[model samples]
Target: MRRQHLAEEIEEIFRCSGGTYGSPKVFIELVRRGRRVSVNTVAKVMAELRPAGRKVRRRRSLTRPGRRPAPRISSAGTSPPRNRNSSGQAT
Candidate 1:
């Protein structure tokens, strides 16, 4: 009777939402239509219908590997001429 009619209306709303409308959205829509239905009731009906929602796809990484490694620089000072000796000792 009343329950069956409500179930049909819920199904219609679910379809109209591209099958992405879960119980919460359906409950809001039913309320907006002046229907005095509870969210739990809508959720129960939706469970019975089992409409499939859209799945979220994972994003791929944008960074790529470089062919050559970067050159390492000394951290002691800037790129000015060094005052050290050729024997690996400071002058």
Candidate 2:
């Protein structure tokens, strides 16, 4: 009986936030409205109701093929290795 009322309240808050209010926000709203409810209870009710918020999608990187040629790195051991300590300081 009480759960049903709480569910309704949760739904209303979720709707009011344009479905962006997840469990935490809903729980805070409930508390603000003078309702004695735990965050866990709100989370459980939300899970049961399944009112999911729309996730903000990340923007895809717009990369264009380089017009200039890439700098060539010589992998061949052309340069002599430097004697460095474990701390990377030149011995």
Best by TM-score: 2
Residue-wise lDDT of candidate 1 within 21-78, one digit each (tens)? 7788889999999999999998888788787556657987666657555788767866
Show model 2 residue runs off by greater than 4 Å. Answer: 58-91
lDDT of candidate 2? 0.89
lDDT of 2 at 90: 83
The Cα local distance difference test for each model comes to 0.84, 0.89
Query: Backbone clashes per model, in order?
Result: 0, 0
Q: Worst 10-residue stretch by lDDT in candidate 1?
A: 61-70
> How would you encode candidate 2's per-residue C-alpha lDDT over 1-91 as one tens digit per residue?
9999999989989999998988988899999999998889999999999998777789886775666668998879687778999999987
- In model 1, the clashing pairs are none
How far residue 10's Cα lies from its native spot in candidate 1, in Å, is: 0.5
If scored against the real structure, what TM-score would every candidate get? 0.60, 0.61
| lDDT, residue 56, candidate 2 | 75
